[model samples]
Target chain A: MTIDFKQDILAPVATDFATMDTFINEGITSKVALVMAVSKHVVEAGGKRMRPIMCLLAAKACGTEDLEKHRKLAAIIEMLHTATLVHDDVVDESGLRRGRPTANATWNNQTAVLVGDFLISRAFDLLVDLENMVLLKDFSTGTCEIAEGEVLQLQSQHQPDTTEATYLDIIHGKTSRLFELATEGSAILSGKDQYREPLKRYAGHFGNAFQIIDDILDYTSDAETLGKNIGDDLMEGKPTLPLISALQNTVGDDHDLIRKSIATGGTSDLDKIIQIVQNSGALDYCRKRATEETHTAIQALHELPNSQYRLALEKLALLALNRIQ
Target chain B: MTIDFKQDILAPVATDFATMDTFINEGITSKVALVMAVSKHVVEAGGKRMRPIMCLLAAKACGTEDLEKHRKLAAIIEMLHTATLVHDDVVDESGLRRGRPTANATWNNQTAVLVGDFLISRAFDLLVDLENMVLLKDFSTGTCEIAEGEVLQLQSQHQPDTTEATYLDIIHGKTSRLFELATEGSAILSGKDQYREPLKRYAGHFGNAFQIIDDILDYTSDAETLGKNIGDDLMEGKPTLPLISALQNTVGDDHDLIRKSIATGGTSDLDKIIQIVQNSGALDYCRKRATEETHTAIQALHELPNSQYRLALEKLALLALNRIQ
Candidate 1:
């Protein structure tokens, strides 16, 4: 069955979501006018607030009543997400995000970079206020891994020899780790130690599936539908799953073409690459892998007592998978 | 009395300084090859290690014999400083810092931005290991302010209406705040609550004096002496104290020229603006202000008992002031 996001997923925690949204606005307030302005611009440009919703869902899934702290944690998660996106846009030289002008485009790279730093520091500042040492340690170490993941992605750029294992490491760092933080952190804050591993596993696999679907879209989705063009990843020589899988399945000319495309990034061979990516069964293999990850993620959810929040999270994972279908 | 940096300033904590330097190398260890390579390059390129030295001296001044924790704190301070410098190079688009290639130059902006982020997270990760909540709060809050200060400086860039008070706020955030962190963090780590405020004040004022002297040298010092070109700040339309003071001391043609130079950044008017800035008595005014700030920084040191460490701290402040003389 098709799922409506607001009704099926966000509806259960809609009030907490609203509170968290407001808190994000309140949290980003800075004495510096430029910081406040740039931060407001980027945070407002956020998409769906998926990570925070996951945090709230995990909190409720743990059967916790008092969500005052979770709401703040959700806002902090979004802030960290927004901060990373700001830097990512600067790194990617992206002009627009979700149809809005990016922080770098709105002001300049300097403003974007510094404001991103402000958001990170502010996020940590608020985290310190949570007064939970365990949460602090998790976040501190998680952010480091997240950064290492990003640098690794950069290091892998234009290299065609990157492996599936390396690709998993990349997605885990760049995509899934923050998701784990959102859910596991909720478990930590809720004082539910037992739920931590399951939630982390659920988020990790879900994050991996989510990123795989995104990389899949980069080779398939139209700009109007996805807000980013097809071949965008290939254009940067980013050896995402599709390109990596395509290399593995093809041989002779097809293999050489994929390697050349990754080595010399551009969309000049876009149509040809897309046709090969599909014809060679890379997309099917990618879809199967994503489905398997989604299944594993859903399976991990069974560790928690069955509830509406858990079902909503399960539905959230399914909704992500449905995008490929 | 000529203050020999080695004998007068670093002499008291020379052994500790050497240990702290080793800690920085050890502290920057990363699993990622690129993170390690870039981090090592920047940390090794660091000059004088002023902030960490201040941290070591402050710990000694507090009569803490076990310099173990203090050494780690000192290393953390340098890491934080290095992180900012990495980002600052990206913001300023600087190629070389202290006559060595910047991270941004050695790698790329994307690498620099990400590695800079890794450094920040690593610093906090190590900080969490310190197990001092007070120290953590100070650093988290201080980093936010530092970022805001950077944004504030960017906001004021080329505006020409930036006041001395606003300028002080900028320097306090961008420059002095870290210095404050280095010294105050020492007090926090040493379990010496009484020394925290005094150390923060001393460092704050000393930072102001040092930056002011640096700004003055922007119009005075040659490339060989300062390792930077003259009028570099004016080239960026930075309305530092010299230009602010120049505006105060001139009118009509001179005032208009300085204002235009600030509003429209470039080195085309370099000689003309330099001549106007010097002849307008702005340099003398800036010198007086730097001297006043140095005196206040020294006065704050009186709160600590007289010891070789305190004397070294005093000498450090004086040595910074002597740069202008």
Candidate 2:
């Protein structure tokens, strides 16, 4: 796994993504200063830029030399994704994200929620500027699906008897759909129909792996790395895949405690629940499944011609899977 | 004021509007249903559907034979407006709306916020399917503008020293933009470009009058008629036009108390403050201005051909001005 991680691949793509940054920040121009300050506060806090990078990589791997459209789409994908996070943090009542106080915690819930809306709408404005009706529809549809998925998760919280099929559906809607659209959208824009399905397959597989690893990180990472306390999910009563699977296998007090923890939500002994999850081996089981998905993701990339960009994408998938392991 | 409020005019329009409810209500499509139920709960609570009706009435008045696009756009406008209300209630943290629990109150703040996102996105989904790129762009732009307006309002809330100019700007953003767009958009879709400017003028004037009358209603209406309690705005520390104007004209503790009340929010003496606003003649003053705007709005309708639809449009504006008197 000692593949060269090209700093350049992301740096240039990152610069191009700044147009989205500028557009979102510029949305406040009519008011002067406020929009810029709030938007900059959130955007400056860095992320992996994974979704945008996926768009760039897919566009490159599909052998489309023109990166301009891919660049904007990448930025739109990232902004749309960021908008969701801002709103999600408010919904989760999370105080911290990416090592900083959330917008809701810092300013107020109203500001955070409104800023999130601004970003989401700004994404659509940018998408429309591309003058591609189909892409616009896909991005809009993807956002609606993501919101529905997040709501589903919120509604299903603390319901101990949740099914595996329900969990999978949530994951697909919340995470995979956007990934599928990001890659598939780039391919479509580039007129690379031959690779669109495979690229979508690749993106979906990668997204599932990424989300599983995200859940895994919740269990394994400390406050410094994960930017919040570990077991925060359990405290919030979210029945993430690993937690749900572990609950099914636990016996007696362990099971009851976990269920009670979820039911009471924020009143639970999170430490005890975390230990039960670790002991149940469910975390390892989920990681193994995620690794299998990573393989499937990489396999989809075989449809693309061999290139440095494609390899970078493949390595990124492996990197996600490795994080879980 | 005693002019007949007919079944066809008020009740049937209300019933028809309610009947055309095409939100994501629950059924076989359970996921869409959940999203819709949360949204419809907020919309169906008998709050005024003024903006959508304006869209419907404007199209018919414009001499356009096609009512289908008008109906769809009317629904979309209502959906958009409802989505904003859901988010606004969360932002305001109010418990009751339309004399019942708000979406955030019934289902936690997160689901309410997410449901807003779903409805707004669904509006675009409807617009995109119309096969008109320009209309899609218009709707999307209006959505972002609405978000921007909400953000601006959030930044300005509870600040009593806000000038009349800023007050007008906030109202224009928070209310008039939707009105302007609803009518202007209908005009665009109905191929009535000659009427776009005049219809926009009509919508803006009508919206201003509509909102001012709404502010007056806070003082004049009871909890039962207005749904939610009266002076909820004052309680929330929002300085609507009437209060803003009153604050400027009054002196000493009258000014000081208004400022303090706004700064502290309506935590105490809200009833006394309502009395203060009424005694200061702010409501009557606002009503006079609203009547002036009503006349201007009626004048804006001169561009439309003579018809019953045009008369209805004129009467709606007059109704708004008279509602609070």
Candidate 3:
């Protein structure tokens, strides 16, 4: 059965999603025109607002009816996500995101960097208004880990010897940590302490699965499929799961080629590398890992009682996995 | 009367200053190797750490000798300041800061941008530990203004139409907002609500004076004294107070040259512009403005009780003014 994203995933919390979108617009209010313009560009360019949707779902999954505060929290999560993406564009020196010109590309790098800073500070400013010390601490610590994860990704770049453990560490920080914040943060704000651990586990595994699938797409999916060019990761010599697993499964020439490609960071041998990555069963290994992660994530959601919001979250994980299948 | 920095400004809080120093080192703890290295490089490259020092002095001026939490706040302020500097170096593309190789120059722009992000997140993480909602609100708002200020400075760059009012707004956001956070945050933490307005006034005026002096020195200061080359701002086409005042005082060719130089940033006409700025009496006008700002900042300290710390805060403002005198 095909699970529709709008019907299966976003449907349960559709009203909350609208509230979240409004909060996102209001949250980015700034006196500076450039800050507002660039923020609107990046925020409007957001894809499906998945993170915020997840946050809304989590709040409802906690069995809370009033989502006034959860809506704001969701908006803050999106702003934080947008902040990372803006800076990520600058760091990657990429001109496009989601097939649109990025903040750094539209404006200069200086504007992008500073505007990104504005979004972060503004997000935190709005967060302080929530007046939840526990929530504040969670977000503060979560954001720090997210940044460290990003730096670690940079540190791993152009190194083919990066281990799977290290790759998980990187993805956990860069991707899953924010997801944990969204889900677990909803639990915290709802005063559902018992739900926090299970929600965190669900989000963590889901984040890992989501990122692993993304890395796989970098090698497997086309620009039309994912809004990103294939071999983009290899262009930067990022030793994502495909390359790392490809190394594990291969011997001799293929292994040496993977090492050289990561160390040198170019797509000159892209065709040959993709062939090796495919023929060596690295794609199969990555898919298996992703599926296991998705399963673990769904299992964690079982700790929560039966509800459509929780089921939507389960379907969201399935939708991500469907990309691979 | 000489107002030696070590003797007059920092001496009053020397013991507390040491405590704050230790907190700064401890605040940056991270498991990521790259984050640690880049953070250490920038934090160690910190200048006299005047923002954090002001925080300490402000705390003591409030008559609170138990400085355990205040030291943490001071460290948080310095980290925030360092985070901005790291991003500023990226924005300006500076190869060196404080006579040391910048993170961008040493590692790369990607490293610099991501590590700068790590610093910001870590700073907020440490801030959450302070556990004061009022202080958090002030910092959160102050940081947004700081980022807005930096963007305004960029927005005003090369326009040659920037007004003194707009310039003040930019400097207050970029410079004084943090200073206000440092001092007013001290008052908030010290539970001295009455001191908040006065401390913010002191910092706001002091920041304006400090930045004006720095902008003036851009044309007047030598590399040995300031570790920055003169004409750097002109090369970037920044419409600083020196140029703004020069525009107010001149007409015809001299006026046209300054306008053209600001609109088209380059040091090709540096010598002529410098001569024009000096002969235009712009320097004297800027000196008057700086002196006025400094006087206002010092006067704000009169609200707090007599203490060596208050005296030190006053001396620090006077010492900044002395840069011109």
Candidate 4:
């Protein structure tokens, strides 16, 4: 079931993604300097451009002749993603993102939120030209699902009773849905149903695995490679799956300490709690779960025809898993 | 034309808008606690519910038979507005809105942003039920326009070079587009073309006057009526039309001081500058401009058939003009 992967898709896709940012710029008619500053700052700061790459790769994989449409869609996805990030930074009260001061932190929260909104709105406008009503429905639904996921995560924050299923629901809403839609949407746009379902499933599983690994890295990664402070989740009071798993498996004072640490969300005792979780094999357990999901993710690609895109996607899943360790 | 403006339309619209908070409970699958908390916090907080009310009133003015659709649309508009606010508060670093601790301030920025995204997504879900592709298109476009407006506003924050035309463009993007959409969307949803164009113009002008009045109120309105500290915008360094126009009208050191105030955002000499602006007749000038817009707004409604909703809308315009004073 392994597919051949290549980085060529990466370069052209990256280029197109760069070009897609233009769509966001096209209808922005305001003379607001801060809007331009924050928007340009966020976009140019550079993310993996994962969503747009998925759009282009999916479109190419589906054997679509029109790269232009895919390029536009890809840009819209990135804009949407960036918009969410601007908003997310504010939500997290994050001062830094992708190694720079966040829009909210750098300018103010109002601009960040509004700029994010502007981007989200622009994404829809970009998609409007594609002339597919169903795509609108799918994208709109994805936007909402992402939001619901965020709310789910927020609700579950600092609650010891938060379950694995609830966590899964949150991940699905916040991360996997958008990932799944990126490929699914590309396939839909290409009018190629043959590869659509499999591509979507593969992307979804990969996204789930990806976010799990991200959560793991939050515990395990150094600041240099990760580009963010390790244990930021803990500091922010987010009880990731690994932490929750450890809490559930603990006994006596271990359980008491875990509960208090999570409740306090990184007091002086946070170091001790991190050690307890590390020793408790929660990290190992979650990492194993992520590995299993990664395996399942690769399996999800079985229906897609062998191609560089398919292989690259499989490699992507593996890279995500390996990156956590 | 004077139209009969009824409290029934507004009252029930407000009630339904209020009830939407509990509607999240209907999403039985997610973390109910989070949903309840986010929804309750957002809904219970005071808002003008202007967009939704516009939708309702527009429908009523058009003599639409199906108030139910308009009602749902109203809820959707409010939800969208709420979502933006959730994100906006985080971006603005605003601690209070309408005299209540903002969602971002009360919960955390992350929760506020995510919850806002969730509500936005939920809005699309509601829009989907309306089952009109055009409505979705309209809403989606409006969403983008709002974002563009926001970005424009952000970009314009400190640039004293912003002209009247530029100012109008920013205001239209930031505020009026939604207002116009709300009125016209209601008419469109209700299939009332006769009122649609006129109602849209009415809403646009009204919203323009409304925002100008708000900008003027920043200097003139006391903390109690404005529900925020006076000159908060000035402190934030947001150069609204009053300042921009005043700067353009004044000469020499007065202009230089105002420009510097805009750049430094009224930090030092806040009172002295406020005095200078007042003495320079900026407040009076802005008020006069707002009143002019208000008159034009009222004039736009002349084409609508005599109805209570139309009159309420007209009164709303007048109220907007007079509120700051």
Candidate 5:
């Protein structure tokens, strides 16, 4: 069955999500005009508000009805997510994100970098207001890991020999880690220690599935499917999972081409590589792995009591997997 | 009498400074190899460890003898300083800082940006261990202003109309705020509520003097006074104090040239611009302003009891002023 995003996933927390949106606006208000302009541009260009919605849903799923603080946490999570994306655009040297001009492209890389720094500092500033030491500890250490993960990805760039293990580490840092923060952070704020692990586990696997699907889409997706062109990862020499799986499942000329593309990044072999990836059974292996991760992610949600919010979260996982299907 | 850096400024906290250096090394420890390598390169390329030493001295000034915790706080301050410097090099596109290759030059912009982020996160991670809500709030808020200050500076770039008031606001954010954090952070950590304002006042004025002196040196001092060459700020179209003062004191062809050079950033008019800036009475005005700021900085220290540490703080301000003597 096909799932509608607004109906199945965001609908449960739609009102709270609206409130959280205001907090994001309030949060980025700075005395500096350029800081606000770039922040507004990037935050408005956000896609789906997935992390914040997940945060709000998790709070409701934990048997908490009032979401006053949870809404703020959700906004903080999105701000942190936006900060990373701003920096990532600079790192990748991209001109556009989700069909809009990126902060780096809108302003210069220097402006983008500094504004990104402002967003991060502001996110932490709002977080300190929560006044919870435990939450602070989680985010502080979590951010360190998240940064390490990004550097790890950069280190893995242009290297075809990057293993699936390394790819998982990269995705965990650059992607799943934040989702874990989103859900687990909500659990922390709600005073539900019992749900923290379950929420973290669920979000972790969900993030892994989400990122793997994104990597898979990089090979097979059209502009409409992903809002990015195919061969972007290859153009940058990024050794994402699809390429790693392609390396594992193929041999002979197919293998050499994949390795060469990763070693010398560009889309010179774009058509050929896409063709080979489709036929060589690598895409199938990636699909199977993504499915396993999705199953694991959904399985962890059993630890939480049944509720519409829980059902919505489970549906959210399935909807992500549905993209690949 | 000349103030000796090792003897007059850092001597009171020299032992604590040594111990604090280890915390910087320990704090940067990461599972990611590149994070460690880049972090070490930038941190090791530090200059005199000024901010951290001031933090230690401030703690001592607050009558805290056992400086185990204060030592860690000092390290955190240095890490934050190093993080800003790393990003600054990227913003300025500088290949060398203090006669050494910068992180961006040694690696790449992407590596420098990401590693700088790691250092910031790691710095805050270490700060969380201090377990002081007030300290956390000050740092979180201070870092936001720091980033804003940086953005404000960027906005003012290449604009000849930038006012002296805007210039002060820029310097306060970019330089003085962190110094305030360094000294006042020590006060907060030491539980010296009485000394917080005084220490903050001292550092604020000291930072103003320090940056104003540095700006003056950009036009008047040779390469030896500062590691960079003369006309560096002009080449970048930075409306620093020297340029702003020169604009205020000149008219006709001299005024038009200064305005044009600022509007179109290049050192083509380097010799003439320097000639006019020197004869413009701008350097004298800047020096007088620097001295006034240094005096106010030293004056703020009287709030604390007279001790060797307080004397060290006073001498530190004088030594900074002595550079342009």
Candidate 6:
């Protein structure tokens, strides 16, 4: 059965979602016109507000009644996410995100880079106002790790020798680490110390699964469905999971092809690379791994008490997994 | 009197400066090789470490003998400065800083942007360890303003109508804000509440004078002397103080020439524009403004107690003004 996002997941926290969304708009208000303009453009281009929703859901799952602080935290999470995307576009040199012109495209790399910095600083500024030292420490360190993860991914770029363990490290930093912060940060704000670990675990595994699925789609999905063209990662020479797994499963020309493709990025061998990544059972291994991660993530959610919020969180994980199936 | 940097300014805090410099080296240690490499290159390429030296001087002026926490604060200030420079090079698309290859030049814009981000996060992480909420709030707010200042400058780019008031706002956000943070942060760390406002005022004015002098030098100094080419700002169509002052003082052909130069950036009429700027008394106006700012900065220092550290701070401000002479 197909699980509808609004009905099965986001329904429970719809009010909080609206509140958080409003808070984000208010939070990005700046004295500088350009900062506000670029921030609005990128924030509006946001897809689904998944991280903030996860934050709200985790807050509710912790049995917190006062979500006013959680709403602010959710807004901070979204701003951080938006800031990274603004920079990521500059790094990736992409013009469109979610079918809209990116900040880099709308203005220039200078504006995009500086505005991204503004968003990050503004996010931290708001986080400081939360007046929670524990939460501040969490975000301060978490953001550092997030940056290191990004740099690590850059270092790993075009290096075909990158391992699965290294790949996990890359994905954890680039994608899952923020998700961990969203849920873990909510638990911190809720004053639910006991829930922090389990929430972090659930989000971390869920993030891993989510990114793996995204990487898979890079090899499989067409532009019409994914908004990203096929072989996009290979084009960039990014040694993502499909390429890594394909290298492990193949030999001779297939192995050399995957390695060369990673070492020398481009979509010149797009069809053959896609064909090998599919026929070599690499997609099957990746799907199985994604499913395992999702299962672990949902299992961690069991640590919290039964509630509609918890159910929604579980459904969210399952829904992500369903994309692959 | 010739104010030698090492003898007149850095001498008082020489030992503390040494310790603080080492802390910066150790503080930037990263698990990611590229992060470390790029961070080390840029941090090592730093010139005079003026901001940190000011931080150290301010802490010493507070009559704080321990000098331990102040060292860390100074290091944090330098890291923040380095981070901005890294991002600034990317924004300006600069090839060299202080005659050394920029991170963007050495690696790529992508590396520079991400590494700069890592530096910012690491700086905040270290600040969090300082465990001063008031200081954290100051820095968080200060960084946001710095970014806004940068965006404001970008917004005013190539616009001939930009006023001195707008120029002040841009310099305050981009330049003075960090100086304010450095000295004010030192006061905050020194636990000297009474000195915070005065220190902030002093640094704010000093930063303005420094930027104005730098802008003036853009028209007067060349690559061999200043390490920056003459007309570099004009090449980018930056509406700096000299151009603003030139526009204010001229009219008819002279005014139109300056305005056109600003509106359409290039060094095509470099000789003519330089001749106009000098003959139009724009340089005299900028010098007078810089001197006035420096005097106000020195006046603010009167609030502090009489000490050698305070003397060094005064000398530092005077030494900056001496550059144009």
TM-score of each model's B chain? 0.98, 0.89, 0.98, 0.90, 0.98, 0.98
C-alpha lDDT of residue A241 in model 6: 90
The digit string of per-residue lDDT tens for model 5 on A144-207 reads 9999999999999999989999999999999999999999999999999999999999999999
Q: Estimate each model's TM-score.
A: 0.99, 0.92, 0.99, 0.84, 0.99, 0.99
| Model 2, span A42-117: residue lDDT tens | 7666477778788888888888887887877887787778888888889888888888888888888898888888
Off by over 4 Å in 1: A222-224, B222-226
Angstrom error at residue A310, model 4 = 3.3
On lDDT, the candidate that comes out on top is 1
Candidate 2 error regions (>4 Å): A3-33, A221-224, A266-272, B1-19, B22-33, B46-48, B221-225, B270-281
lDDT of 1 at B61: 96
**How big is the positional error of residue A104 in model 4, measured in Å on the Cα after superposition?**
4.0
lDDT of 4 by residue, A16-79 (tens): 6567667656644444565667778888775777777777877877767667888778777777
The stretch of ten residues in a row with the least summed lDDT in candidate 4 chain A is A1-10
Model 1 interface DockQ = 0.91
In model 6, the fraction of reference contacts reproduced equals 0.87
Alpha-carbon local distance difference test for all models:
0.94, 0.76, 0.93, 0.74, 0.93, 0.93
Q: How much of the true A–B contact set does each candidate keep?
A: 0.88, 0.65, 0.91, 0.75, 0.83, 0.87
Candidate 5 Cα outliers beyond 4 Å, as residue runs? A221-223
| DockQ scores for all predicted structures | 0.91, 0.64, 0.91, 0.51, 0.91, 0.90
lDDT by residue for model 5 over B6-93, one digit each (tens)? 9888877888899899888888898888998999999999999999999999999999989999999999999999999999999999
User: Where's the lowest-lDDT run of ten residues in candidate 6 chain B?
Assistant: B221-230
Per-model interface RMSD values are 0.5, 1.6, 0.6, 2.7, 0.5, 0.6
Model 6 RMSD in angstroms: 1.2
**Model 2's CAPRI class?**
medium
